[model samples]
Target: MNMVQLERMKNDKGFIAALDQSGGSTPKALGLYGIAKETYTDESEMIQLMHEMRSRIMESPAFTKERILAAILFEKTMDLKVAGKYSADYLWENKGILSILKVDKGLLDLQDGVQLMKPIPKLDELLVRAKDRHIFGTKMRSVIKEANEVGIKAIVDQQFEIGAVISAAGFIPILEPEVDIHTPNKEVAEAILKKELIEHLKNLDPTYQVMLKVTIPDIDNFYEELMNYPNVVRVVALSGGYPREEANEKLKKNHNLIASFSRALTEGLNVNQSDEAFNHMLDQSIQSIYEASI
Candidate 1:
């Protein structure tokens, strides 16, 4: 493990940037960036355009370690070059930002009112590749749509099970069991999730500290205890479809939780904007998120 990076992650005052929109979410991400589906003829072209957009964001002066502690990357992005260096290398060496890879193979069909992550085949091989690329950690996500105890427990179990493997392989694993913001019983689900997570956290190996990426709890500081757990390095909140403003507001109310936003981070960015306009917009976004984080 990179001890410097680990220390920074444990103590950084900035938010993480979730730039890891995979195959399923890429189209929507592009559309929000002012690129239409009709603009790309094939998967290759779509991926290329998506890369271009990510590169643009990464290269911006505003996207630095000053306000962004790390970036979560798609596999392709980790392999691809940004400013003539591999994305992870560029992020760490040039920008001082750590890189985390999104390792889940997306979620399975809804079951027990939750969507558990699909099996990650050849995970060891991927971890080897990620480590070679200078990636610092891994992130996997599962979703909870209701307050079903059985479902929520299943989700947490899977996350910790996979997280243990990732940790054993020498990378911190960010276990994200996101509670759907639109769930009618969102608060109830959060309560159940908190209980399950605490139990799992208590049983984790003392040497392996993991991070968490979850939805902002329905109650302010509801996750305070989770943050204080010795086995927890940090607890970050996903925007989870909230508008940037609302997400920031909610985040501010939760003292220790920081943001790991996808859409909200790139809310007003457009592909056609001038460099000055683009950087200005990104600067504003970064400042807002950073302030909320601190």
Candidate 2:
């Protein structure tokens, strides 16, 4: 649950599959399979659909072969049951896929196209449940669209503050301060983000290691320092809506970070495909992502 546990998980050298879609994102992910939002008019029905989708994925060779070392799960998927067993247990016992919980309560809008993760009420209680469930770590998202110094600093401070809380409760915190790929000033944003992150990490206790999930930088060597930071277990990239091939190409050029991609990882996969076809598509995808990661 802490750095020791996270370091053990990292020894496996495989990418993390992020399937932690929630609320509107959940239905959007389902739509990839021609599933309509109306099919799940209630929360319970939606959860069932998500559970079924995850069950099929976990049963595949992509998982069984250990191509995916970890999976980031939405709250519903984190608690999902398969054959009367918690899905996390099923994956860990059967396939060596460690489970991670997405603890952010979604995003709240701020000005200038910036957003902060909604505060989780009773977050301490959530961490306790996650620890009991054997979840490996936690991930949350905050975004920077256009970097104003004040806004960027605030984003960095808030993330580390929450990250510290999560780490103290014995979870490896993945602090995601996503610089939107579409921003015209992505280079500047990455510069500012890198500076702020280093300052914050310097102040962090050396005992608590953390992870960072950020947008692929547009400039070369933009994150060199942070990538090699001693307390950073891994620096992972988010797809941020890129297609699988494009993301892979960009990822291949980066030497120090691996991926925790969601949409890009699932781009060629489809629910209507036969199991064999699904496996083939997924295997190819995982192989490419794996290659890029290393």
User: Among these predicted structures, which one has the highest lDDT?
Assistant: 1
Tens digits of per-residue lDDT, candidate 1, 214-259, equal 9998899999999888989899999999999999999999998999
Alpha carbon lDDT of each predicted model: 0.94, 0.81
- TM-score of model number 1: 0.99
Deviating ranges (above 4 Å) for candidate 1: none
Measured by C-alpha RMSD in angstroms, how accurate is candidate 1? 0.6
TM-score of each: 0.99, 0.95
Candidate 1 clashing pairs, residues 3+ apart or interchain: none
lDDT of 2 at 280: 92
Model 2 lowest lDDT segment of ten = 1-10
